[model samples]
Target chain A: MREVEPKLLKPLVAGFQLEKTLTKYIVSQHNFLYCQKAADLDASVGKTTFTLLRQINELQKILNQKIMLYRDRFSEADVYAVYCEHPDYEGLNDGTFVDRIEDMCELSTKCAIKEWNKSQIRNEAKQACFLFRERRKWLEIYKTIHNETKTVWLAQRHH
Target chain B: MSMPTIPPEPHRPNRKEVIIDLLESIALEEIALSHILNAESEKIQAFVGECLNFPTKPSSKEIIKFNKGVTQLLESVVMKEWILLRKLENVLDFEDDCEPHHKKCESRCHCSPCHSCHFPVCKCRCSHKKHKDHDCYPGK
Candidate 1:
């Protein structure tokens, strides 16, 4: 009944058309059969990279929120907390390391799970289209998450 | 410099086809965005356009200019390489056309002695050491 195509389909078509023009523009030759393979791979990689970063950014935001919640909850409390201010993560202190190691073990395990997630993403990303800078970025994100999560692991209330 | 796995040969889209598809997709994206942003004023819409971007957003004015410059240079290089390769091929073909097929130059070059030359294995085609591709003349 509608005169126009679906909104999603339109962008897809547009992306395809744009890819063509850009490839031709990038490769310049109508006869790009040889280099075309690499070029297409590169394009696909770029797309995948963009998607990966966005997902990572989403994850970062979630972590940011978690850290922030604690920041607000314990800002005025007597607890010792390590605060990451930029997109802040509020780390709290639960007595000290002299506390139950079982609780510490449990927390460490959770942080390990997050580490596993980061590696899984890297593995998938590399298979698709990994670049040095992008890889570096993933590392940075991982490190940020790892450090914060470790802090969270140490500071979170253990059951 | 992580290598993007070349999609297996069967799955890989042809460059021409990919290019055409990309162009269409790009146009569609712009039009879609245009409609999406039609409600907003030009200034805010422009910001919206930038915000909506992913790694590969559809075509924009800047890309057009960049494409033109890069495409022109790329086109020129590809054409030049093709022409040069073709010329080299023709010269070899001309040699082959000779009644006896370069028995004279054959002794002179001793191409078989060259480690890189494929001439020893395949007598007909001369993939000389200097050239990157299979197309080359057996420098007389």
Candidate 2:
């Protein structure tokens, strides 16, 4: 019975660790993308805008993957246990899962604005792209912190 | 210099009036953009209120779907206007140099009453004088 218990726990522990690693990676990548976008906005036209947007999309895909994995490995009951154990767990899970989602939404908004600015520039119209770029930066930070917080919440479930 | 010909009527459109009218038109576009954004924001606030009152369990799927729609709408209108405003600013930079011909008649004419018109109606020589006292121009 003792041997069986250890074996049973192995996969669960491994899965939990994998989730933590993935969450960290996603958060880091999100931050990197944001910084890149800001640098691009500061630079000359055409080069920075599209590149930054592509990076954002890539980071978003990675985040989605991690989120899916987290969902797949753990049942709602497991998540609820973590929520019950952690003091701030409810804060992390409630209202769209982290304040970061709101930040990302804001970033997505800025991306739309940036895209519009690009079109206007193509038409030879004068326009500022700074506002959108600024919002994107905030978004990147928000996503990173959000992922980290979720990962911590999950890790607490086991200990 | 040959005497300037006087119009039989008290209303005639002048070059200065036209420039002022153009400026007004441009200004109106900016105002329109702001109004549109304001209205959309109000709608979003109302939607949020409704969502808060909903008795059903909040589904992540539903929240995500609604969020996406709102993001798209903001992008389409508010973002587009921001870009347009930038382009308009550039146009203004160049047009500022030329002296307006209608500076003197701006008060008397209704053509450039606001920033929406680039051609001020000639109250001194134009034919549309007896129109109802509209916001700017009355008859024509």
Candidate 3:
């Protein structure tokens, strides 16, 4: 069996298109579901959430272009064939490159969602506080009215 | 059929519950990724070891080239990770908290970007002695 060519391996150094991986694993698989759920629950938050998602997507695209440009400065193939030249290369169990691209992307969304949830909670708490204050004021007014009516009824009974 | 009584209000999902779910998922992902990165690094290291271990040693030039390739691979990995981490931090609004300290600046200190460390300049006016010479002093 021909040993794994170093030339082929060299491409892998900077080769795996992370943008594509993130887009595939994150934007396509994860974000769509989250967006749908967020929108279903709340419209305003859903709009902001979509905006954040767009920013992330744009960031990925810009970085992808930058990395590609930087990578272009280097030659594609070089004389690094020593690994393949080893006699026992065939016996060597070169483990598979398990790209944890999904996990990383998932973490990104996890963080983004967490922030959104925090802001949502904050807004909810604020609104709840306002309602509580309003209700308290009404309760005080009702109590005063009840006290006046009771006093008038007692005087009438005494008379 | 007899007239039914008024139904109770539908249960609305609590914001805290959703936040808790998000936090849990984030924690789980971090733990999984930590292990995954370590495992992947080991695999790469093993490959590099095999490349170096030879019956008849190759020329110094070839060895250097192989090492260079390995370094480049590792560099790419680190860069990718850094990018993702920074992006994550940005998403979470944790950019103000610089690394090493990672503590919020209590005093009126502005965190300027230091080109050397790529981390923010730690002029947090904290107890940590100011390294004026190098704005991004990484060490304690």
Please tell me which predicted candidate would have the highest TM-score against the true structure. Answer: 2
Clashing pairs in 3: none
Off by over 4 Å in 3: A1-17, A27-39, A48-52, A69-71, A76-159, B1-140
Predictions in order: lDDT = 0.32, 0.37, 0.36
State which docking tier applies to candidate 1. incorrect
> For residues A68-125, what per-residue lDDT tens digits would candidate 2 score against the true structure?
3333444434433333343342232232212322333344344534566555333321
Higher-ranked by TM-score: 1 or 2:
2
Query: What DockQ do you compute for every candidate structure?
Result: 0.05, 0.01, 0.01
TM-score of each: 0.17, 0.28, 0.21
Report the lDDT tens digits of candidate 3 across residue range A41-148. Answer: 233233333433433334334343333332333221121122223323222122111122222233334443456664544443344334333433432333343335
Angstrom error of the Cα, residue A36, model 3: value is 3.6
Q: What share of the true interface contacts does candidate 1 keep?
A: 0.12
The window of 10 residues in a row where model 3 chain B has the poorest summed lDDT is B91-100
Report residue A147 deviation for candidate 2 (angstroms): 51
Model 2, span B48-67: residue lDDT tens: 44333323433545534544
lDDT of 3 by residue, B25-57 (tens): 433443343344445445334433433342244
Between candidates 2 and 3, the one scoring higher on DockQ is 3
